[model samples]
Target: MALAYDDTNIFARILRGEIPCDKVAENDHALAFRDINPQAPVHVLVIPKGAYVSLDDFAANASDAEILSFTRLCAQVCTSEGVHLAGGHDGFRAIANAGPHGVQEVPHYHLHILGGRVMGPMLARKA
Candidate 1:
């Protein structure tokens, strides 16, 4: 089931130009910008221009062209940001938080590209 699209989300505002963002890269289908609160030295966010609540929503509702474009734009952003350096010797991590359990703060779907340092484990081990 597709979730309702929230046009009032911060990302939507950014995409609509209602708000300003430190833009990194933009293509026909996606827009990338530096995160206001970054977790890593190189923290960028890539989002599809279309409105989707989460990754599942995006996968279910977005067109094939939108999917391909968004994915390609993400890789382009990584390359432009030099995240994958020296022929992939250095790499970055792309993350998408889902619902409440996944810690998704924003309603709109986005991919967080984090790198520029050794990204440690994703979670701490439970003792």
Candidate 2:
């Protein structure tokens, strides 16, 4: 089932211009901006202009154009941030945290781009 879209979410507010954001890049279908509470040296949040609660919701409910545009915008963000180097070892990580288990703070689906330095593993080892 498709999740209800929450317009009150911060991302929704940002997209609607109800809230201000430090925009980094924008395309016809998506917006890229710096994270207020960054977890990495280079942290950016990319989200589709469309309303979707989670990645699953986005994948199932969003249009093909929106899907393509969102993914393309993500690649653009990595490139623009200078973390994704071509023909080199330099690379970046794009993450989409979903639901409570994934620690998704916002109800809206978004991608986090992190790089510019060596990153640790996605999870810590169990002691």
TM-scores of all candidate predictions against the true structure: 0.93, 0.92
Looking at model 1, residue 109 earns an lDDT score of: 96
Put down candidate 2 lDDT per residue, 1-127, tens digits, no spaces.
3446778999999988999999999999999999999988899999999888889988988999999999999888888888887757488788998887888888899999999888879789999
What candidate 2 gets wrong by more than 4 Å, as runs, is 1-3, 87-89
- Clash totals for all candidate models: 0, 0
Candidate 2 local lDDT, residue 21: 100
Candidate with best lDDT: 1
Which residue pairs collide, candidate 1?
Answer: none
Model 1, 1-127: lDDT tens per residue? Answer: 3346779999999999999999998888899999999999899999999989899989988999999999998888888888876586588999999887888888899999999998999889999
- The per-prediction CA RMSD against the true structure, in angstroms, equals 1.7, 1.7
* TM-score: model 1 vs. ground truth: 0.93
